[model samples]
Target: MKFKSAFYLLFFFSAFLSFDGVAQNKHTFEIKQGNFLYDGKAIQIHSGEMHYSRIPHQYWRHRMQMLKAMGLNSVATYVFWNHHEILPEQWDFEGDKNLAEYIKIAGEEGLLVVLRPGPYACAEWEFGGYPWWLQNISGMELRRDNPEFLKRTEIYINRLFKEIGHLQITNGGPVIMVQVENEFGSYVSQRKDIPLNEHRSYNAKIKDQLVRAGFNVPLFTSDGTWLFEGGAIDGVLPTANGEGNILNLKKAVDQYHGNKGPYMVAEFYPGWLAHWAEPHPAIDASNIARQTEEYLKNDISFNLYMAHGGTNWGFTSGANYDKKHDIQPDLTSYDYDAPISEAGWATPKFDSLRAVIKKYAQYDIPDIPAPFSTIEIPSIKLTRVGDVLSILEKQKSVQSTTPLTFEQLNQGYGYVLYSRKFNQPISGTLDVSGLRDYAVVYINGEKVGELNRYYNNYTMEIDVPFNSTLEILVENMGRINYGPEIVNNKKGIISPVKINNIEIEGNWEMYTLPMQEAPDLDNIKKNDVFNVPAKTKQLQGKPIIYEGVFDLSEVGDTFLDMENWGKGIVFINGINIGRYWHVGPQQTLFIPGVWLNKGSNKIVIFEQINSELKSEVKTVKTPVLNKLK
Candidate 1:
């Protein structure tokens, strides 16, 4: 039978004790007799992985309910480090980054949680959740035994535990398992040129450290099925990550875990990530159903890598490189076509997966929630605020002998402009040796050819005029969060702003444009901040902050249609919704109703390209997510 009274008593008691003394709370989850046991009963985990940083704070439960409706038993999430700690000794867990709130919501909805507190989480995230400032530490080495890295890692882990550690099932919270150093087996060995043997030692060390720090819940490791030797720590549970080939994967797990019971497929690829220029990858619903059935039939457990992939707001989207080390930046809309849509709506894949999972789940699947509707803004005439240069003149600038990284300048996201003047006429090759990601070159306030570090385009031939002003605007499209390259992801022009292999000398002015949201439109023209919308025309090449008003009859979740616009970001009522690119696959940004007012609403657009566009920004129920950049 059902023991509701006993459960409620235990839950309330845990809550009472948890508030007073977190360490006093106690619950148990362990492996016994070849089965995963929770509260003295064996249970199979049908789970999905979603990042709270990707989705908004308000939609956490809506997404959890969506996960439950899809017939998953538990929710898995990656606790991104950079998202929480933007700087040393500082943290932001409020709003969307609130990990504790998300976990409690999952528990309230009758779902369990698996927390992946990655000192490094390569979920297409910038620096793989690593802070950009770590590079400034003289002897800092990440994902290793370096003292500086270890010390900082311990501090972050300790800080995280204080926030959500008490929420673990042991303390009446839903978190059941905590992962150790994500997917380390593949990258660590390759990066250090060491064999898998050393990887085992490193993982064991990391796992031991986590244990010592008091994460008493079951600890596990996740990696590809083929990279078994690389990622598996001898004592921790070994989970495979793949979309196809289940039988061999199980065999590999058995071999690694010493033929242990309770097999796990940690990262099942539901949908693929989209790079700027590549086609969005959509998997067949039939394939998803088949895989779910196969795993259930064999008594195997799995977690879809992205049950609901959300947006990568700001400059947090990452890039991938070839053997040549050219970057392929991922699109901002993570909207991985999972069973749950990015806007938290059900899809055909959800229906198929739900039907198949119903046959095996001991608990009844809940009814699906209706999706939030959309609204239209007939037209929004965005008034031009100013260009990057004009905005720069107002911002605090530092004259440096050399260029500074984003972290060095205490800037987190957005673009950086490095400016210098050449008195004599000089025309040859312009070389920015340490161009971290992408750059736009200009001379004498005129545009020049662009360069992208992702494709190894570093040097360019430019025609410089006499007494020309040289400006190199660098955009950290994203940082490489995976592989050996992730140790230190410092943004912007790292070294000297050079020209033709010679360092440009002079009092160099640096402007940091970590654009989060535009200032109040009425106050914009400290320089030319307040120009009438109807009269402003002819915007220069520099990025302009465009603003206007749109009347709304009612508020709901809507997609900002950008079919004809260039790449930039959108803010509504001073809330940063997300970024939008001319790139196909994600032509619109999701704007939630919670951010809108009843009648008059403000719309701000930071257009990096052409300013001319349709007078009205319309909203549609459908999203265009199949096109490439």
Candidate 2:
């Protein structure tokens, strides 16, 4: 009798998971006569969007298990073009970005895939996920049908499809649907540079490229209901994505995917993205349940915009701007107040949403996977190992009549320092109206004042000494990912540094400080000059590299409390985890267990502003994401 019961349970599970099996026989899924029929059987796409590049590879299974446990049947992800192709003609697909491996692994977990391979995925990702070198292209207008941009976009899309095209459902893999270009209506509708036909042509071209590259899965395009008219293309399933107002969404869907029947909310935002120096974006867990229930009650197919809002990791975080042109640099912690937090632990939001899904999907949900471990490590003693001045001694310098931007210097990400010597003594407001972002003004390597793009604090009047060497260190915090301004979002002192509205005339020395990799700890530990200012407040205004070493009997994930610290980037064991600032909202840096060691570990931080307190770091069990501006 027990054996018979077990067989029945297995059969029931298999029957309920038919959507996954839909790929097994015909290898084709279709939406006809108002139903998404798989093997002629209707199936609901209970899905969530998670990026493999955002989450650590080691925890991929853990997160997927969490998603499945939520009664979800499918997963969606975006392929970031800039991440793989860092330089011109060079590419990498190994490690976390292995598209084929990520899809195969999701299939192994019994979940179907919905691939959103965007040559332009604007998920608060840097440059809307376009490589920096693309800006150097002559007459290149991105996200349009310009020949140069199109040629490059096609090259990247084709190369990426070659990696995962065979894995589509039609080809006997878990991938079922592929998205054309990301929401372009709200963007292109206001563009004065590109023509309307070019926008329409580019939209069609993206789909054509996908088909030519062997993606036989059903194709779809997504946008907010308001943008459907401009963003959607003919013959493609148009999907709506936004937080609430389901009534209007349904009406819009009816007009577009109306006759087609099955519709999808490709990006359902449970929580929103927050920027540094701003209030944390927190949504009530109850609201998450209510909205999710609304989708289910209407029998609408939806995917959580972010099931697990993992870390931005490294220098990949992007920035955004408002109508006022206020630049808001996104906090490094993508924690997004998501159901699964940055530390990969379940929150109340997860529990609330799970109950809704269980009732709506009518599936027997499994036990939640054991929560990932977290530990509070002992205090780490950090020593100032290097100063910005010493590090510049051995670097190459660019001399230009005007201060060149990062793109002009063939540089991307990280910070750049512009130095110039003024033989004439002048006193006036140093007009840095052309400053792309933030800069620390220095008189002979000493910090004077800072000009910021966020608050438009771009002018400073200071005394000028004769033959005084001036140094300005500018950080490319992030480029504008979404806006009419993206085409010109180059970083650093983009134009010639001017004094009193007149461009300062002088030969400039430029240093490229793209901190892609961590510096050698041995060299830092050997240098003692960096200790001078740390011990005394005299020269604390310059950027300093603080190194720390600690031994651990065992290693587990922990959050580094950076509440007392200032703006800077953190490196653990010679790997950049991302940036941190003493702004409201995210003040903790997640140190993953996968990046830690049991024996010994090295940490280096390049701090732009010195913490008022001693150079100290503490590991905490939880993250503080509720701070208001």
Candidate 3:
């Protein structure tokens, strides 16, 4: 019997090579018209973005091992959808807002992933990534096809594709490409010329609802290669993201047909984010390592809009508008002076783009991951105990007496308190016709006034005394970045509140302050109240509190410089580190070392300027104050 059929044909060829090495260790991924095949071959992604709620799940595997030691085989996130459903049906992946363990630790570091999920994703985030409770419903028309914005963008793309569509890459996982709604042709166009075709049938109905909620891969859009030939689709894969070169990426690969297959660049801006007084915006890591060595010497495929610009942390940052109308608002330190530096460290443009991506990477690159861990805390003091109108006049019978307007008190994000009872306290020019950026004017509580939309004159007049009760408060201090007039942003006084011009309305009292529920102050009364003041004495002002204490046994996360303090708000152990303004671009204030508490950690600081010299707690792990330049 021929030696027992050669021992059953060598045991069936050794069990078919051990089941094809367990299907290539199971993290599949295959796609064609833009490459990315994997276990089946054709690869070349190089991705980077980085945003697991802006980095901090214990530094997400030290920022995905410094993006795979810079040769970056893949990693691109966006997820946001209001930082993972902040409420309505509540859902949060995990601490530091874990988006599926930052995509299974970018597949335990081997890499490969590219999600986006949007619901909008303008990247400078907040609102651009939608979800301020979807602007309290009621006729919301964002990114078109408005049926309450497609029923909350199909319930946040079907609960984020049922928690990250089985981790993509064709189900075995590690994604591969998901980006459907991000750059909608950089804000939809093609009207009278007609081809808009309902924005390509709502992005082919979100790619047939992500292949009927399963996402089979091969689907791409990206836009901005001269507006991707009227927002591409015809069998998907258009690509081209921004700041082009190489003959504009070979005319976007001769408009699809020549099949350039995968030449991404989905953002690339090495640095540029600031808005308020506008001046600090630096970018040269040798021109982002000579435009990333001309996109890896033309093998082209990019990402980097933020290789690690972390910390939009709260009120989720976003705003940009330049076609000269100016606008600007993106500085919660998404330090897109990228090449990783919002505290994951590694900069000099991350060693000049990791030596030009390890000289055009063919393979083997991993080494760079060490940095994260800093503690300075020198001299530490920042005291200010009382005022915010004396805690709203001791909670005037539990607040909200009407005047509400940070969108009818659903209160989107921090600071808003209209207040008005002016029996006739006329103070000449006090106009505020839609000042959405910064204002602090009082009368009875007495701080006289101040208004600034970067000095575009929001009308100011002093000395009002008489009937007393004017209080303005208004401090969105962020929003309006690049435009089609951001649907007229509109915050407080978008068209009212005049004094000598007479229209000061009455009985107003709205104080929403969506400080997202933090201020409980344990029934007030805590009196150790330190005081420091007298550096030369200049503490003569409106509602100042400032208090400080620090012994921190050790918890983590730091960044609180707020550039020499001027605008207000900073609280720890009591929480709220949301607002800080020296005006010319936001200046650092993230705190969250899990909200610090290893021992003795109070730190309050209201400071609208009763400036007696305290503000100095330097615990940096990088938020780039450049020592307030």
Model 3 lDDT tens row, 1-629: 32123222322221222112112345445555555455554445667888888766776888888887776667788777777777576777778776766787776565667887856676767566666656566788566655667777777778777776766655555667887776777566534333477777777776676677777776677767877755676777767776658677666755763555656677777776655456667787887888877776665667877787777755567676564433456666666667777777787788888887666554456678777456656556654344556566445422343444576555666777677765655667877856776677877766676776655567876656667777777777555533345555545556666767866654777654555544544345543232454431333456556666777767777777767667766777775655566763557686757667788888766666443455565656656543333
lDDT by residue (tens digit), candidate 2, 1-629? 32223222322433333224223533446677766655555666778888999887888988888988877778899888988998976889998778777787787677778888877888998888889888889999888888898889889888987787777767677788888989887777668577788888988998898888877778888888888887888878888887377667667777877554576788988888988888888888998899888777666778898888898888899999875646888888898888988888888999998887766543367778987678887598876556665577457899898899998888898888888888988788898877878888888777788888888788899777999988888888788888787777888886667787778866888898888888664554345345533553544777777778888888888989888787889999977899987766887899888899999988888888763535567889888766644
Cα lDDT of candidate 3 equals 0.64
Mark the 10 consecutive residues where model 1 has the least summed lDDT: 1-10
lDDT of 2: 0.79
What are the Cα lDDT values of the candidates? 0.76, 0.79, 0.64
How displaced is residue 480 in candidate 1, in Å?
Answer: 1.0
* Per-residue lDDT of model 1, residues 1-629, tens digit only: 22222223323332322323233445566766666676665666778988888887888888988987887778999988888887897998999888888887777676778899977889898888888778777788777756798888888888898888778776666788999989987786567666556566667777877787778888888888788777877778888888367678768878988786668889988788877756888899998899888887776778988999988876678877666756667777887888788888898998999998776654557899878777766566664465556666567787887888887887877888888877788878888878987777777555676777766888889877888888887887888877776754788887776667788866788888777655565655555564644434544555667777877778888778887787677788887766676756678777777788888988887766544633446667667887665
Best by lDDT: 2
Q: State the lDDT at 343 in candidate 3.
A: 70
Q: Rank the candidates by lDDT, best first.
A: 2, 1, 3
Worst 10 residues of 3 by lDDT: 14-23
Question: What's the true lDDT of residue 250 in model 3?
Answer: 62
